[model samples]
Target: MMMTERGMVAPVAGGSVLAQFDDVLAAAAPELVGHVQAVKFDADTGRLGVVPDASAYGTKLRWCARKLVTAANAKVQGANVRTLHVLAPAAGKAGPATAAAALDRQPAAPAGPVRTRETVSDGYCRALAAHREAMPPRLADPAIVQAVERQNRALRELSRQAFPKPDAVEDTPARLQRRRQAAATEAAALRRARAEKAGRQVAASQRLEQTA
Candidate 1:
């Protein structure tokens, strides 16, 4: 017999039962200690009511119910916690059900104009164009370069879907040649700038060595 917090005789630990069970659970499963809100043990039927902080934790507790029962019975003498009942989280706590109810209470979203393939294609094309414009000409970091390449590939795929082969017009030979020449000119300018910067660095290092 155990004495209750109210000075009444009980078959098992009454108010103190909660603290004892908390310790047992913490020792048995440390991860679940923080999730458990409260513990109630019914000595008559040997049913243990475990109130969790959330519904997710309740599910988790249920998964390891057998292990908990075994651990509890072994740790607490005469505990005989046979059945584990995972009670709902305390009132006022927002759970999945509560969130769903709140969503149901909200007004339905206003209807908009129906979109067609042309509209979607136009949107994708605009987005791809904007992203391409925003992308740097060259990325120094390998990681940044890889990331930019991935984005470019995704955008290009979207653009291809937007402008299928049958509908797209090919660029003229003259225009293609001009684009190639422009790209070559840009590459040459970049190389020249890099070379100049390297030469300056080397000259500065030589000057430092002479002074030393």
Candidate 2:
């Protein structure tokens, strides 16, 4: 990984993360132009491939890749900055580290999931579904993730929490294989919707062309 560029500072400091595609490819060739163009990760199918053809998007791709490299490095630097200002605990010297250790030595109380008990917010239920292992087999299943996410966004606004980002975990080889199989199941429904939309647009355009 590249070090932080000159004059860049991170907001939160250090965290492990990845950009969607470019970083995976351009790691080998830092001088490579354009983004890791046309990348796909097929979990079930166990596929990780990229087109790497950034002729049209060359400038934008390189700009984004450089930005991603800079951001990751800045995070590491931020943590080092915080440690420099740690003040020693006073003349009698009751140190914060000693107090922290005392707190850690106490027996930790057991924690459990918050009980909604029939008063579940729509957002929480939807989050559970979106993160489900095997989604329900019903017509309601298809729109549940969307409904939950939309509701979750509204709830986040009300509660002052940030909305969740898109999935960041890269699938393991096994999970990728399962997701590939699952993806196959959804592909037909996806195709049907696209064909229906395309047909409607084509019909409307043909009518205009005929009248012209």
Candidate 3:
């Protein structure tokens, strides 16, 4: 054990108020560095929290993350908690909104044996629902409609890639490599989430966990 800033022998590492938000997402939504960010504690509570990008998909991601946090808190030493926050408006909110609505209308292409209809539909729904709220009135121009549609299509394609055909293993080596890279990137994000969450768990009020 080591002495905490308060002169107490804290049991865990990186448990500071600053640490709680160290991994907080730089932006409110997951538009860039995309995907849901989560925190989990391995040492004590396995306490969990999340920071997801703002959009329809973001909401879905938050829901799924809470479920995991709930399960972990129940089984682990530390209880899980989450904070719902909103970020200031972004410059391109209109773009995301238009694209999402257009994508929601079309079905994504199938990835042969690896992809599932259910997964594709879910992705399409998520893409369509993104940025549904708070779109600027000025973006209603016809020019933006086409551009937004294209962006939405691109987003749908990315979602389609989430599920490979069951036989995607037989696909080209380069394609497989790309997919592998995507998986690795996703793993790094999960690690970041856990680190941030553990920090928050340690700093909660005394009545929360009653740490020594």
Better of 1 and 2 by TM-score: 1
Q: Kindly list the per-residue Cα lDDT of model 2 for residues 16-36, writing each as its tens digit.
A: 122223343354344542433
Give candidate 2's error at residue 179 in angstroms. Answer: 3.8
**What lDDT is reached at residue 109 by model 3?**
52
Residue 100 miss distance in model 2 (angstroms): 74
Would you list the clashing residue pairs of candidate 1?
Answer: none
- Comparison by lDDT, 2 against 3, better one: 3
- Point to the candidate with the largest TM-score: 1
Comparing candidate 1 with candidate 3, which one achieves the higher lDDT?
A: 1
Give the CA lDDT, 0 to 100, for residue 132 in model 3: 65
In model 1, the runs with Cα more than 4 Å from the true position are: 1-10, 14-16, 91-212
Q: On residues 1-212, what C-alpha lDDT tens digit does candidate 1 reach at each position?
A: 33443445434443445557667778677787756744456766777766776777778889988988888777766566788877756445534454344434435654896676556676888999999999989749998889999999999999988878964767899979999999999999999999999999999999999999
- Candidate 3 lDDT over 132-166, as tens digits, reads 65455564878889999999999988877986668
TM-score of each candidate? 0.37, 0.16, 0.20
